[model samples]
Target: MKKILKYTLASLIAISLANCTSDFEDINTDPNGISNESLTQMNNHIGGSFTPMFLNVFNVTPAWNFQLQQNLLGDVYSGYMTPPTPFAGNVNNMTYSLVDGWNGFPWSDAYGSVMPFALDIKNAVALGGDASGEKFVHLANIIRVTAMHRVSDIYGPIRYTKFDDFETTGEYDSQSEAYQAFFTELGTAIDELKAFEDDAQFAPFDMSSLGGDIAMWRKFANSLRLRLAMRVVKVDPALASAEGEKSLSSDAGFLEATDMYINTGFAHPLTVISGSWGDVRMGAEMESILEGFDDGRKEVYFNPAEDPALAGAYKGIRMGIEIEAKGQYGAHSSIGSVVDSETMQWMSAAEVYFLRAEAALRGWSNAGTAQEHYENGVRASFGQHGVSGVDAYLADNVSTPNDFVDALNATNDIAYPSDVTIAYNTSGTNEEQLEQIITQKWIAMFPDGQEAWSEFRRTGYPRIFPVVVNNSGGTIDTDVQIRRINFVENEVNTNGDNVAIAVGYLNGPDNGGTRLWWDIDGSNF
Candidate 1:
């Protein structure tokens, strides 16, 4: 991990130098004239550092990087999408073979692209001693929490709190510890930014849909706090309640009207992956629920299958099935035009509503009611996608997910897991009501498989079908599903001792089967 940190900084410095080499040659004719202070004026150093951090959160460039960073992992695991192509002759992530080479992207992308830039901003601000600049650090902290939390969720323990210390940079914090830090940092950022709520310094560096509005960033932070708070309700109910209530009471408010999206200034990666490369397609679970409910957003989320046999119906492939070649499923649904823009969605207004819905279901303070929040989540999603017929869609309680049928292979088909309905179940049990909320949340949070996957592991709702094939060699259970990706090979090779200790923090072995600190077994309630 020390090497990892060094490489991160070295890479950042290389990029910085590469961008300014001509300026350096011209300005540094007299070496003494070019001081570190002088270089600060060369560009908006502090503000410029933020671009990579924001972009790397989802890794928008070079499509394949995004493919590994998220698509192959969270997107598939959440049952939102699957790749039609089978690399390694089908013994890949979908089959639970655990591709170490491919799995390292999530880790490397964060450490390489996100963490160093954030730390650079923090250090640059502190060294400058500008009280006005302190706001930048707070903002960076919020983004850090936003990006690193996903990394932490992917791998149980990560080097987070003490990452700045070179000597102990390799030491790992358990997921619980890292999550606690996330809450603390988010709370501090939210509170401190109140004084700078009207400050426009962040505007220039703002790549998100909020347009550098400090108040909106505070809302995003507060909403993020709410999300992390809800994540731990089952494991640490008291702390979860305290933090959740704090977020609810904050004047910064929650993401209600507009969703948070980062303008990466590149074509949406899914356009390439699903459209050009023919790699990814819609998942079976999406077809079951969306089609069964007669969801208006179904067309918004996916294109109809081009296979002439399916007669242009919206179709998706079941994951982890035997695939001799991509052609068998290549004509299935590709991604819809919703992601045809340059922006990558971070958090949806609908997701925040669904989080509130879960908080209400858990009987947290200030949470109005589960049904209200649940329905609002649906409406928000409907509005987000320009879908109509919400009233009729919400009234139909009899509709449940349709059983899946593989267009090419009967062996890959399965029954829809539950009788959960489109309408909120007021008379249902706590677990049943939770299923309804999470199922809706799952539907609403399309393409954001990272959060969706985490929610699925936490609450066990919207029951995903078991894989059609198991290839974990008994290390992972087909019924239990893949818990977390194995610790990356780079960590194992470069930071062996620390990685060993990190594995000890897991509930089981250091494999895809092991549950993280929050992924406890049994009832969500």
Candidate 2:
């Protein structure tokens, strides 16, 4: 990582134009575009490429794009939220009918924004010098894994390892293969960064809350390794243990007291979409689960519904109902003030504790007792939300997720499927313990529906409610629900050959019905 002085996009062009004064009129090319001098500017180096990649992963502007990229798909499917408006006549993603146009954002946004910038950083560094560029390349690798894993989780297969060259630029790797690549990349990054632990090259470009500390970045990489390792525990137990233990054994600590959030200089997308625009509302499951647990954080997570008929209680809407218009559910609980802050969450410390809890239940080395981790996870979440009384809440042990009742439409309501309680059940079976850990994790990771949705597909815990309507045109089963989004239509149109090969990598049809590689649709025990 080279220390490059930050320059504005305008200044870079100004300098290039100032230098080319003699030949400026002869060459009628825009100097602001990727001109030789513009590309060679100090700001265009390894550090420069990161801002674009970081910002794009959780895109800030064009709120509608963020809505499609995450809110509508993962957020709704994970049982964390439900859209108030009846999109496409109530036959859209909420109803299991895949929307080609809406489903394309996550794919297009990643490739169009995050992926290309990551590749540019790698290329820009490699073309300069190997020794000097190695650190930058490793940093780029960490960012790549962070962004691409979500993309792979969405579509089952993605162009990752083979994205370097023109000949194989359009190639795709199956989810399993991509996970392996991610582990390998993390391993390399952790190892290399340890040697350069005192390096200050990363300071100039640091936008993370960690402030470009190499040691902290090393810890982040290790923590990420643990996360990915646990993601595959069900599908490949041995590999999961090996990778997970490596993380536990490392001196680079996991994210414990602090979380990973970037200061993006904008309001959280959820605030704009839910609070300002009134497009999203609380999910019925949220209302049921929080009320059942008597969770105090609910006050911070959601606002009291405006529907006077409900007497100012927190209410949520169910997915896939006959919504005539947005106004029908506009008065329902919109996202609360917690999301109005000006930062985007990449990961949470509470989530790490829950992950450790699951790893402990699996009898992994260095994970500590399952009960301890589970309680800590709850405490971390409570602290994160500035709520007190965690000890009393954790001790009750009597509360269970309440049966969901949709006041708007009782026909769509469902009873609580499981009786799992909050207190740590030390004598319970492995399956019971796993469910407790996952369910707590699901709650702590509110608003981050991508990871929650992936966990739901893999573990089948916490019992997410199924959609009331099945509108997949005989392609998706309502019980299993939508597993993963189909390959983006843009890829199919421009890269048909690769898309065909990618579809073959899927376990089932290349639609929302298909599960990804790590999402084994069976018992973990």
Query: Candidate 1 — which residues are off by over 4 angstroms?
Result: 1-43
User: Which 10-residue window in model 2 sums to the lowest lDDT?
Assistant: 1-10
Number of colliding residue pairs in model 2: 0
Q: Model 2, 1-525: lDDT tens per residue?
A: 001111222244345345423343322354333345533353345566788777877777778888989999888888888989888888899988889999888887887667666766665544443354578778878888888898888888998887665557688898899999999999989988888788877787877877778888888888899999988988899999999999989888888888888788877889889978899999988888888888898898899999998798888887877788888888999898778787888888999999888888888999998899999999999999999999998998799988988767778788979888899999999899999899889999988888889889889977888777888887888888788899888778777888899999998888888778998877887
For each candidate in turn, the TM-score is 0.94, 0.91
In candidate 2, the residue pairs with backbone N, CA or C atoms under 3 Å apart (3 or more residues apart, or in different chains) clash, namely: none
List the pairs of residues colliding in candidate 1. Answer: none
**Tens digit per residue, CA lDDT, model 1, 21-60:** 3354544455445555545443367778899898999999
